[model samples]
Target: MLDLTKLSQQMQGMSQHINREAEASRKRIEIALNLMEQAKLNSDNLMQKHEEFKQRIIFKPATPLEPLNHYPYIVEPPLAHTVFATDGSQIAPSAHEIAYCYLINVGRVILHYGQSRHPILDSVPEIYYRPEDLYLSRQWGIKTEEWMGYRRSVSEAIILAESGQQLLEISPNQQLNIPTLALVDGSLVYWFLEQLPSEARDLILQPILQSWEQLRLANIPLMGYVSASRSSESLSFLRLQACTFEEPNCLKYCPGTGGMSATGTEKKAPCQVCDPLRDTVLWESQLKPGQRSPFWRSNSSILDLYDHHQIYFCYVNVGMEIARLEVPAWVVENSEQLELALGMVIAQVQKGYGYPVVLAEAHNQAVVKGGDRSRFFAMLEQQMIKAGLRNVGISYKEARKRGSIA
Candidate 1:
């Protein structure tokens, strides 16, 4: 049991620290806003600087597709439109359990607004227990959690693509020619693949890219919605403008405090001007409810693998919080698709009271409660026992955790 007295004492110190940080952040935001205003006037110079330092900057900076201060009012959604969303939950492989296996459950939701069609809601659950599925290699040097996460992401995207294809097929017969939007819960960029081996990366990424292509061919706009996002790519651009150095070379000027190392190593140092500002804070201050900031292209290294399906994003104020909406390059290049995607997103958020209704429903379908996990293991053990399998049991530590006795 936790000691309440001790926790109370620690909480007081934590509160004081947070207060100090908050005060510092308030001052930094003022400076950042001033820099934003300057950036609007000197947008051309910033663009030039971005081109010059594109390769040297360690942090991901957004490439602006519109004016620095452009905030467009949310376009009203079509009276009759369809929205499809998918979310996934996973049960990581545990050594203490009866079996060294994992589970992925993807929940899908489809809602038809301004029409009488019934909503579609369902979940797909798959289990992987094979050695090849559980491990990256025979030696088990690499953990399966990251690989499993990648697989789950692939499943989510594939499901969305399949959903889009199905919608397209039936739309012609059902006369459902209204606009449609597909949404996923988080980022589309597979950042984890950056460290994986090429073979492993391709094996995992190909399916996702194919699914994206399918959606493109189907002419369905897909989006990744991140709520209360803490990404700082936009702020990184501001940091470039706030650089005091004449050349703005991150490596040479902003090396470690002791300057260049003996080995001439390059290291990233935080800019004193905009060290802690986030994209959410910047947009939250700039955009009104139901408004969206100008679009920007992501510079994530993983995006290099995205090819023509490059990811672009914008910040939308959904009343409750600022959300980062990531869409494919194809969707952004087409004005009709872009407007339909954005309008549907804002409408969905409004209907769900600050969250997308389809996403929330999908999350509800995908979530696995603690009791459900316990029951799953119990059923697995029972089935194994029935099959006359020997040595099928949980670890002693797990047993103790399940039932503790003084």
Candidate 2:
């Protein structure tokens, strides 16, 4: 039944591709290593130069990013604190299924270290079949699975914020003062919403802003943790510092060729002085266990949509791996809150072997396994039959497989 020879051939081809990619990546990393060595020698000069480029980029909006300083420090968390984490998973609408429906399951976990004897856990499942939820506006011009995924992610984040808000208000008999750190599994900024029309985007933002306000009022620090992040925001800044041409000079010295003769025109400057590598690559070796880099604010246009909740981020070494942590402007402004959050994140990662334990549990709780998904559809079909509704049978191919497998 299996083509072992063909499978072996395919594996050999994939191995070749992996080797090629590895070589290319090595070359790219070498470029970054050279720039970093240069940065150490001229740190003060680069710092002042970065400010000049940042100012000049405002007037000339076409060019890319600004470099920021990388300052690393270690933070020791308080002995007693509570970590509330929430994660979500979803089953998308399928055509072969009888009903046009989608399900989102959110898992929330509360872990109180040095304050409580046991962890608390909960889960909420939401099923959507409303007309508005099933379809998108015609003007949006897309009905792809990616759009549904984005909607699900936004819903998950809102629910997590709400759960965090509720937890902050809880009053227990063991009334010792303990710091609370609320965490979500992804970025705080809804970057995907930038593609939608202003009106549609505003509608989605309304509930998220309300949820954020609840957490803000409760004074709980919320963080979005991304492991093995590929974001190059910091690298983009480094490129600006490494580039030979100043922002203002790009107009004259780096003007396009426009088919002009080389004899009369100024030579085009080299566009990129350093290879495009992720910010983590530079910090992977630099950040020690429990240490974190300084904050770097994103200049993404999507950030403008979030007036007060704009995002700022940093990288931390959690004893096992490097991770990116994103926080809102509110967290960045409060020094005590920021320090507490950083410490807790590091502590959680150390406890969980490079990942947060609460988040891992939340994910396990939320995940919809293959067996569970099959059972869900079977149950739905049975309900439809009981209600005297005609069932749209599953695809013949699926039916055949199900009949033969068992």
Candidate 3:
């Protein structure tokens, strides 16, 4: 339950905080504006900033491609094209069940756009009840869900990769000239891997990497599109370049400069000078319809493990939302593939009213409704009963809710 009054008060405080720091944030933006144009040509400046932080920086926001610029390059997708999108919905482990169980539903959508629109949609639900799947620790001491949700995420990526392969076989008679784009619904680099144990990460990330390899080997273009993204990796780079601090990683030692308070009386916290704007918000004014920002490589520490699969991103305004799109290094290096992917994504967004039609369809197919969850558990209960198992009833609290209504 939420305390409405307290939450309301916090919102007021947040507004005041923004007001207090507005001027300083504006100044920081001005400083960043000066560097934005020269960010690429003056690589020495960024390099010096990077050298200052050295090993202290957790994630480095270096651009392996071109630097920040406002040049809007709109790539019109091929007149006849096919787009494939995959998304996943999961049922987390619940305590009201007889057995420790979970379920993952992966939804896939393949759409042919141009003269005639033909859409193929499918969903596959995977159920897990094995001891290994339910527990993480050696002695079954800790539940897998307790640690993190990486298992489901990894599974989703693997399934998404498989779906991409299936898209290739969709129509053997189709012309080879028609561009095909494979898309997933998140960042290409799995940051959650860093949270898991080293051994667990190795075991899980392997399949995801293999999926990327599969797509690459088959000459399929893949992308990860995040709509209205809150990621600030690009802003972090701006901070590094805009900071007045001569030393590397001043955020570590300088507690005096974080986020601003509602009142200007207190010292600001670290990284507050950047004004806390996400990369998307920062670029909303810069990009026009169908134009995408320059590629920014993700500096996440987890990205180092990707080897050849490191991720790069660009912001695209598809006449609706400023979306962040991520792709592997291979995709970025290939000029033709990048242009086709960007064009197809923009086209999809326009067709779906600010979102990709295929992705939205995949999401619809993947979603698990509340009634569906209830029925699933009910089915499990019946199976338990039929197997002559006792003590398989739900918790008393759940039972009371089932019997009571507001």
Candidate 4:
């Protein structure tokens, strides 16, 4: 059991440290805000600086598409539109379980506003027990939880695309002109693929690329909504503005060294003024509710593999918190579709009280509670017994945890 009494006693000291950190963070935010103003004043030259130093910068900074200080108010949503969202959950394969299998459940939701059609809400669950599904390579090792998470993200996007296509096929002829927005739960940029080998990354990315292509072909705007996002792409741009050097070279004039060495050799040090700030810190006060920041193209190397589907992102104030919305280049290029997507997202947040209703519903449909997990194992055990498996049982550790003697 947790020692609440000890934890309570320690809270006093912890609170003091937290306060000190908070004060330091406040100072950093003030400096960052000043740098942001500088960035806005030098907005025209900012992109040139980015282009000059992008190859050498150690961190990922977003490429700005509009002026840095631009914050546009929300546009009115279309009178009649549909929002489709998909989310996924997975049960990781465990060695201590009675059965060596995993499951992926994708929940899909379709909400139509100003239309008589009923909302669509459902989940599709699939089980995987075959060796091919469980292992990427027997010599390398069984697929890890991280791999499973990437797979789940891919599955969510694919389902969202399929749902959008189905909506287009079934909609009435008049409703065809009405806008549709497809949303997924998180970042569209597959940053996780950066660590995997080319072959392994291709295996996960090709399917997601195909899904994005399908959405693009159907002229459906697909987006990923991240709540309370900690992304720093915007902050990174401001950091570049904070650099005192005319040409910022992270390696030649490293942040770790504070500057070049006495012999003109390169060393590195963190930026004392900007290192502690996040993009949200600078925008939380600047952007009013229903306002969104300017768009920026993600500089992730993974997007190099995206082919025609490069990703762009912007920050939005959703009343409760700042959210990051990522979309493909096609969505950003089409002014009408982009506005429709932003308006619908803000409207959804209002309807759901600070969160997107369709996404929330999809999550509700995807979540796997503890009781459901227990029931799933029970059913599996019964089926195995019926199949004449004599030695089917959970490992000792699992049994001990399930029924602790203490």
Candidate 5:
């Protein structure tokens, strides 16, 4: 870059001045040698690089990543006797406190479909999620715009992880707690479960699995739910997908330390134009993992964009409808972030259809699984008995198609 020339000139001038000053002072001229040595370092490196560039080894660019198996909307199945579809939303802080929201679609409740807003997982903490720990701002002040954006995004994700965990831990003491399947909206679940530095994954999942043991302790069934919406993170992702190539700055890639060894080469050359935001994005992508992806991962992979986890609610041995759900866009980041519901993901859960016979009441339903557990269960049973034969013993096989879980 032209900047290199300026830096070299400045360094040479300083070296020349140092030598002159040493000679005049009649002091240790050896110190001037050290200065000259430092000044010559870049020059020598550049010369070596120039020579290497003349005969640099050629390697074919990587073929595009073949996506893994095509995905099916795999959701969790309701526990035996009752299927519960639940989703959560949180209002988290964002840039300029303008607020970026996210919605969790949990699982689909086919009954009383359309728009519904009852949180089936009642005991969840309903806490806000953030990715940054104070440690981030402490080490790098807010003056660092890049760090600030990272902090905001990460802090929000962390809030998601914690709050999501609470969502799973809802009830612990119900008798017929029977099996239960939980569904969530959006991508990337398990709170970075797949992300770990080997030892770290084991360290994290160990405790997480233990926590889930609570359900086993209570003899209840529980499964995690997840949903994905590419439209949520950035428009650039969509743009990248729609096109085959983008300018280096437009597509996501970092520069080499010397602007040659770093990654991010299109099928041909890169963009010559300079864009501040794009440059910052490249820098951040280099420093962080998974360039251009909305979700988080430790690996520097291109396919991370589309590769998401699918936690099943039922066993392959047991056929059940799996569902994914969605809430409004505005509710996920700003506003209440708690989406009552614009959409509900529907699918069969494993184990069984849950046989939950709940009616659509004000976007609410009571499913009675023929068991005495919590007052919630009692109320549900009453509702079922009151409903008469029309909805009793309804099979999810039938309901899966009908979209009737309520």
Candidate 6:
């Protein structure tokens, strides 16, 4: 009787284990089936697009079209040597509305432009947008950070950064000088410019390249301000490699990206292999010129005498690379500098525009779209107004730095 009791307990345990195993196996199969279905759907979509393209070619196949691009002509050296930064931004599903703007500075006056224009704002559905709910988001800006969908993050980040640049261009009066340095909020490399449609891409490159031609002829100085948005974010990525992941390829620390090339007025497509970081500072490089070592990982890009200060965008042109670097940590402390710059810009804008604060709203209004943008807009507005600014409105959408996009 005792042996029979022990055998009965063993049998019950075995049966429970088998049942659990079967359930686990069933789940795996379900997952596999779902993935297969998704793959099939993607394949079908590609086929349909291919067929459509084929039809266009069959009917419209004609001559090879050569692109004719013209650069603007400027006769004289800009009144005051200046800097102009042009930028563009895009949302996930709403590719139709890529934000394009420019910032101009003749080494004195800050030219800011901000307008919400929808270019190539497509109502296309992304694979991730739930089919049932996609109709609600068709025309609305679609964005969400996904690990597997990292490019979405990149695309949106670039879009927000671009809007900030455009905010600089939308001067109420719209008159700017040449020989300006454009302090773009991102990298100096236009490799990613090609990611945009041809016309959309030109909206960004045309002005700067035109200025480049004019400046080159006039022998003037006009570079861009390209810097990382937040220093902490940059630090997080660095620490991930330095303390967390210990990623390889870390070489000597450099102040700027070495060996920059002069991109012509004709914009080209973005190179896939190009590094995603800002072009202002060579994050991973040795200080020596012509060394050509691998990328570096450190906060030594442009540390001020005290330390790396980010609030004030630092302009460092080492060899061919001209970059604008911001130390977010530093920006938090010395906000007065940012306020001073905005104050100067607002004053300049008001000199020509009707009102100061009202003019600033065109760009500032759009900053708050979905939720509480009051704290943010108020802070920026207060900063500008406190600086005795001229009152040129700003699009809050364009002003929110990286990671601030909704």
- Among the numbered candidates, top lDDT falls to 1
> Which regions in candidate 4 have their CA more than 4 angstroms from the true location?
137-143, 172-175, 255-272
Question: Candidate 1, residues 1-406: lDDT per residue as tens digits?
Answer: 9899988877878878999999999998998899899888987888888788777765678889999878989789889899998889999999999999999999999999888988999998988999889875434355788778778888898998989888877766553477888899988776778887778888788999999899888788889999878788888778777778656676676665435566895433655566667889988899999889999999898888989999999999989999999998999999988998899999999899889999999999888889878888888999999999999999999999989996
Which candidate wins on TM-score?
Answer: 4
Cα-based TM-score, every candidate: 0.92, 0.83, 0.85, 0.93, 0.25, 0.22
- By TM-score, the better pick of 2 and 6 is 2
Poorest lDDT segment (10 consecutive residues) of candidate 2: 58-67
What local lDDT score does residue 125 receive in model 5, on the 0 to 100 scale? 20
Q: How far off is residue 148 in model 3, in Å?
A: 7.1
lDDT of 3: 0.75
lDDT for residue 378 in candidate 2, whole number 0-100: 82
Q: Compared to the true structure, candidate 5 yields what TM-score?
A: 0.25
When 2 and 5 are scored with lDDT, the better candidate is 2
Candidate 3 lDDT tens digits, 243-287: 556675654765545345678555543544555567776677678
Error of model 4, residue 212, in angstroms: 1.0
lDDT of 6 at 313: 29
lDDT of 2 by residue, 1-406 (tens): 8999988977877978989878877786777767666765665665566556654442111112123244557587888888887787888887766777888888888888886557878778887777677776445765635556666666766776776655655663342257788888877767678788887787677777777777787788889999888777766655544667644345555565233465875433353433445778777867777667768677777777788987888888876777889988899899889998998888888788879998998898888999978887788889888888874568777678768965
The CA lDDT at 87 in model 3 is 81
Q: Rate the local accuracy (lDDT) of all candidates.
A: 0.85, 0.72, 0.75, 0.85, 0.29, 0.31
* lDDT (tens digit, per residue) of candidate 6 on 158-245: 3333333443455323323322222333433344443445554443455544433433333222222342322222212221112111
Better of 1 and 5 by lDDT: 1
Clashes of 3: 7
Off by over 4 Å in 1: 137-140, 173-176, 257-271
* Local distance difference test, candidate 1: 0.85
What TM-score number comes out for model 2? 0.83
Give candidate 6 regions above 4 Å deviation.
Answer: 1-180, 195-208, 215-220, 229-406
